[model samples]
Target: MSATALPAGHALRRPVLDDLPEVYRLLVAHDVSVLGFPDLTEDDLRDEFTEPGFDPVTDGWLALDADGVAVGYAWACRKGTSADVDIDFYVHPDADPGLGGCLLTVVERRAGEIGRELGHGRIRAMVGCYRVALGEAALLAERGYTVVTTFHRMRVTLDGDLADLADLADLAGPPVPSGVTVRVCGTDEDLLRAAHGVKEVAFRGHFGTVPQSFDEWYGHFAKRSSTDWSQVWYAEFDDEPAAMLLATNAFVETDNAGYVQALGVHPRARGKGLAKLLLRISFAEMSRRGRTSAMLGVDTNNASGALSLYESVGMRPVLEIDVWRKAITLG
Candidate 1:
């Protein structure tokens, strides 16, 4: 990738923990301009600093203007030593126009370096763009990135009527299939491991999925401030773990919504109502906790018909994000 120089009066450097507040502001500003509301939390910003296999010093960048105020930020993260890298960058809406492209070039170069270090001859860098950000999408297209798939941010409001329905359903007992039972995974190591196993098996064929060891998976989630053990649930068929769901407080800070981070059903357990049942249970719990809504993201092209399932549960698309991909040949 060719280098793009930043505008005059701007300086770029590695981001440090001290830059967290400024960087968070830059991100929120960018999102607010595009989506009309902030989609990130300070905790989410902090979690990125310690993501697995990510080195903020080398893989991240912060751009400041003449007064040394943060105007742009970017980072690239490798997926478990694989050639696939996830990248993201943001420029304040009022910042100079060229800052975003400059930051993207820097992170793309870093992604290439990561691929070479992994001894891979080719690599793929993926980024997500808000569907409404036409200018941003045009810039990415100019740099050779192409849309791979679209993802929808789906949400369901937990209003009084829905809350009442959820409570009635709970009183009627879980609507799970015969021989299947669902319960929270709690803090039990074995149960957590089982949940991890179910996630791996269930998402094996998902688009852009990279296999991760149980320790890797657990460490990644355990270190996140949004993680709540009480929100993790697993379903078993005939006493054998068959499905898993992980919920987090990701949207609680900004949207007052409970976020379903992951929901997967083992192949052996497909065709059963386990997934829907877990979602209903989650809605009940979120309502009980006084959350106004629940949200999750799903790939529109998911082969499992996840979009339909979510829609059947009264969830509607609130926003759309397009996944962009660019493949590079490593030297």
Candidate 2:
């Protein structure tokens, strides 16, 4: 750990695996202040440390006060081989206000180096801020980042009595299409591949989507401590894979809810009620598993009518997050 241009009594250093607890505490404090609840579990933070291409040594920085207590954290992560980089910085509400700018500067510099290494002429630095955090949003605006899009964290309460697929349809949505079947995706490699394929095809042209190989997709979830393979589901139209839904234990610890990590229906399969069908199926399964609620995030401006689809299934917006972007030239 070495001191950077931090305040006279503060220092910055690379975070190590041993710093998980302290880092989690810092993050929860920040989240609680801005979002009114701790949105990330310790396992979630652990997974971030091991994300496919993230290098804890060079891509992250931790700020500490004179007493050596953690006060801020920041990191820059490149999305696959693309020029789009996701960066986040959090400062303790009581910490020095300038600490965020210092940490962000380090993250931006690292993002540039990443873009140049990948042979990109320029990079887009993006960050997500809670809509209610006016100060944080203003800081990003001051640094030339503009709000690109807004995302809503939606949730639906599930009644535990959804005894069967038939009951699910009666309770929430229409019955599955004539030839469509929905089933839990076990650990079978072939089934996993099919689900991944459906996802890649379905998410094409969506905002901020970076295409990923099957191995990349699998490895990302496999490394997450919270991944539950049984929670993954896929749909088949006429015995051909046409949609997929991936759920995780992301909200189990904090909200006693099942988090829908990804839900997608192939282009050719749209407008056939597959999305709503999958949502209802997932809700039933989560309810059966004793989860009181199901949760997912969606882009408010999604052209695919996803927001309306979720709303139709009883999911309501519980939180709003804004994605901000700033273009950086790699020289």
The residue pairs found clashing in candidate 2 are none
User: Which ranges of candidate 1 are over 4 A from the true structure?
Assistant: 1-3, 163-175
lDDT of 1 by residue, 1-331 (tens): 2349889899999999988999999999999999999888888989989887888998999999999999999999998888889998999999988888899999999999989888889999999999999988998999999999999999988754555344234523356668987878889988888999999999997998989998999899999999999999988999988999999999998888999999999999998878888888888788788888999999999999899989887789999999999999876
Summed over model 2, clashes come to 0
Please provide, for model 2 over 1-331, each residue's C-alpha lDDT reduced to its tens digit, 9 standing for 90 to 100: 2213687798889999999999999999999988788889898999999898998899999999999999999999999998899999999989988888788889999999999989999999999999998878988998899999999999877764444334354544446769998778889888899999999999988889999999999999999988999988889999988999999988988888999999999998899889888877778677778889899999998999999988877778999999999999877
Report the number of the highest-TM-score candidate.
1
Query: Model-by-model lDDT, in order?
Result: 0.89, 0.88
> In order, what is each prediction's RMSD in angstroms?
2.1, 3.1
Error of 1 at 314 (Å): 0.4
Relative to the true structure, candidate 1 has a C-alpha RMSD (angstroms) of 2.1
| TM-scores vs. true structure, each candidate | 0.95, 0.94
- Quote the lDDT for 25 in model 1: 90
Residue pairs with colliding backbones in model 1 are none
